[model samples]
Target chain A: MNKDYLNSDIKFNKEVFKTPENYFDNVKEQIYAKTIENKDGQMQSRVALWTIVKPQLSLVASFAIIFFIALFVIDKTKEITPILGTADTSSYIYTIEEGFLKTNFIDFIDPSDSSNYREEIPQDQLAEYIKDNIDIITIALLD
Target chain B: MTDRDIIDGLMNNGNRDHLFRLIVDKFSERLYWHVRKMVVYHEDANDILQNTFIKAWRSLDSFRGESGLYTWLYRIATNESLTFLKRDKIKTFFSFTDSYKNVEDRLNADPYFSGDETQKLLYKAILSLPPKQRAVFKMRYFDDMKYEEISEVLNTSVGALKASYHHAYQKIQKIIEDSV
Candidate 1:
């Protein structure tokens, strides 16, 4: 092979190849669009700290509210005294009049009388009574 | 704008996009031809060019003033072309096919190839060299790039690149003469 012959005979042209019309015009736009799309996707997929903490904060706030309401209701119930005023029983015919019962109950119950005997209900009967009276009011007060 | 002006604009957060567009507009054609000569297809060249610019955009922040912007861009474009060729070669290997034959077929059948028989022969002869040698030959012979500039793009010593180009030239001459 003759290097001189090859060099003289062959001519290399860079302009031999062609591209589609307006190819370069759109390349920058295409790349820019791709970058923007990637950025948008990243933003959409990102999890904000507030998004996660907001639900947890709301849950804690709800629990605190419930606790404070329960405390208020319990305090109100404790402040209520049992009704012990005398009652007019002339218009009401009953097996036990309120005034008579109150007067007798006060006389019968002596806190200092240790020798007084009182019958206690059986454990099973007391358990049955507790189960039957278990309602929202009892649950709320207990909570 | 000058390379320094472009670099300064890129450093400024406000002017980055406009300056990058300027960079792309300025270098795209040169880089495209450089890649197209190696890849031998318009679409493949376009892909390589896009990859080159994307890589540049991603790493623009780390670009210090150590090398000229043109040299940096050329380096990126060259690496992308080589990587594309490597991937293509791997694919061809896995498929039990000849990589050079595939490129030859593309070169012959490509609609955009308007070269005469002699030019076609020259291209075939050039492609016959190893990939790195082909790049060196194309840069020196066709691009008319100096050995120093080619060295910067390839990250190789100028002496080694000159030797590679000389060898590539001899090989291309022999191939062309044999084909003739």
Candidate 2:
């Protein structure tokens, strides 16, 4: 076992071991089988389409429900109710004119005189005003 | 087939399994011996070799041809063997007086080990070195691998590997000379 002797002897024995009979063949199959088993396990563990999409579907449904509820609440709040037991002709007419003017024109100009711009006009005053307002009808008839 | 051909086949969906089988058939023996020399037991070497291929199969898509396929495989095999040795060392630390004594006993009792007295002595000398140096010596001496290739597998510089192999050789020579 001298150093030089050992070095020389090492060159003599290129291969000095043994394995089981047909080890290469058996090991290849063993490795393939193991790989196949792992592949199958991986496939089994994959996330399904339903699993991924279910949460997204739920989120969309929740958003839709919230949007509809908001719309319903807004519509209910926007409903106009007339004051009970009162013939409020001027106020009702003003509300309808305001809505029509908002929808039809960018700017509104009131033609009524500022002194006559009353919030509440009595039903009698309205009837008298309609009876006396013959000039617009006469002009239309003449045309 | 060439390494590139094997890699191309592995990248293909239809031929991946077949090419992987070819890879196993072609390189298993070389990797087995490489791992066997490090662990010194057939069963341990067998486990390490299997783990190496399984790891290669799992990571084949990410290989990117950064190194030769065989070199990459060798890197995996070497790492698996070294990891096995480290784990075994930790176990021996808790249970035995000396880690190499356990390996020597395993070597002596291993049914697959049929080396003569001189070969056994040589193996013992090699095993007495630290695991990393032992790896360098095994790859350089037994496998006839170049320092550059060993560098790729161990991630050490060629100069460092050469120095490690030289130190391993001197220690092994001294051990064998003393046992004479």
Cα displacement (angstroms), candidate 2, residue A76, comes to 81
For model 1, residues B79-122, the per-residue Cα lDDT tens digits are 98887766565455555567668667978998988888778878
Task: Please give me the DockQ of candidate 2 compared with the native complex.
Answer: 0.16
Fnat, one value per model: 0.38, 0.46
TM-score of each: 0.63, 0.64
Chain A TM-score for model 2, please?
A: 0.29
- Candidate 1 residue-wise lDDT at B129: 71
Candidate 1 chain A, run of 10 with poorest lDDT: A38-47
Please give the lDDT score at residue B159 for candidate 1: 94
The C-alpha lDDT values of all candidates are 0.73, 0.75
| CAPRI quality of model 1 | incorrect
Model 1 scores a TM of 0.63
